[model samples]
Target: MDFGEFVMARTPALLRFAYLLTGDSHLAEDLIQEALVRVHRRWSSIEYQGGPEPYVRKAILNQYLSWRRRRSSAELVLAELPERRDPALGAEQIVERDEMWSLLATLPRAQRAVVVLRYYEDLADQDIALLLDCSPATVRVHAFKALKRLRAALTPTAVAGASHGRA
Candidate 1:
């Protein structure tokens, strides 16, 4: 497929991947745009090689993983925003979903990326390791740590304490 066709077919999925990595819709859009710009230059070579999707994905991942250090000390808090309620989801489900996103936001960048790749993207550990340029054991460790943190935060006592303003 040509570059335009490739982008037309893949942009939505790419945006979703970026959104999972970023947890911010605008930031995800920026990442995809930047990644597309970078990939456009090498479109022919990438198409000649295995495929463009992997290259574009890598560019997006690199853009996301590196954006943290490139920016200032200010951080984007994605947890709280004025968004319209989804009519299809019940209040409890919305709360759970918001809580999940907030919890994801708390994780360190690498750990969060690993979690998104392994679970949300449904990638195997080795594939994630390759994408992150780390060993499979390291991927497993990050996944383990992310899960551990999520579990600790979700425990009944922990939730109760948090609700009671007890850190």
Candidate 2:
């Protein structure tokens, strides 16, 4: 497919993946723009590899990883706290989603990427390993650690209850 056709077909999915990786819509847009630019420049070569989507995704992931590394290296101080959430926006599902995202944000980058790829992208461990340039065991370990952390954070009451029962 042509570059434009590929972009039209893939942009939405790419944006969603980027957003999941970055947890920010604006950052996701920036990531997609940077990735697409690189992909466009190498479109012929990427297409020769049989598909551009994976190549674009890898570019986006690399860009995100690089951007995050740079961002973390710079220290910034906030003068004040941000505003509170709107009470009118108190849908249970939205709150749950926000909580989940907040929990996911606590994970290390590789673990977060592994979780997003395995669950959100529904990719197999082997595929994620290939994409991340790691072994399948490494991917599994990341996923295992991420899920363990999520479970502990999400269900502290259950864990507490189990501890009480054991006592």
The candidate 1 region of ten consecutive residues with least summed lDDT is 73-82
Please give, for residues 57-133, the per-residue lDDT of candidate 2 as tens digits.
88887787666432223221223222335777759977898999999999988999999999999999988987888
- The Cα local distance difference test for each model comes to 0.82, 0.80
Off by over 4 Å in 2: 47-50, 68-90, 157-167
lDDT of 1 by residue, 105-160 (tens): 99998999999998999999998998899999999999999998999887879867
For candidate 1, the per-residue lDDT at 54 reads 73
Report the C-alpha displacement of residue 142, candidate 2, in angstroms: 0.6
**lDDT score, residue 34, model 2?**
71
What are the RMSDs of all candidates, in order?
Answer: 6.8, 7.3
Clashing pairs in 1: none
How many residue pairs clash (N, CA or C atoms closer than 3 angstroms) in each of the candidate models, in the order given?
A: 0, 0
After superposition on all CA atoms, how large is the RMSD of candidate 1?
6.8
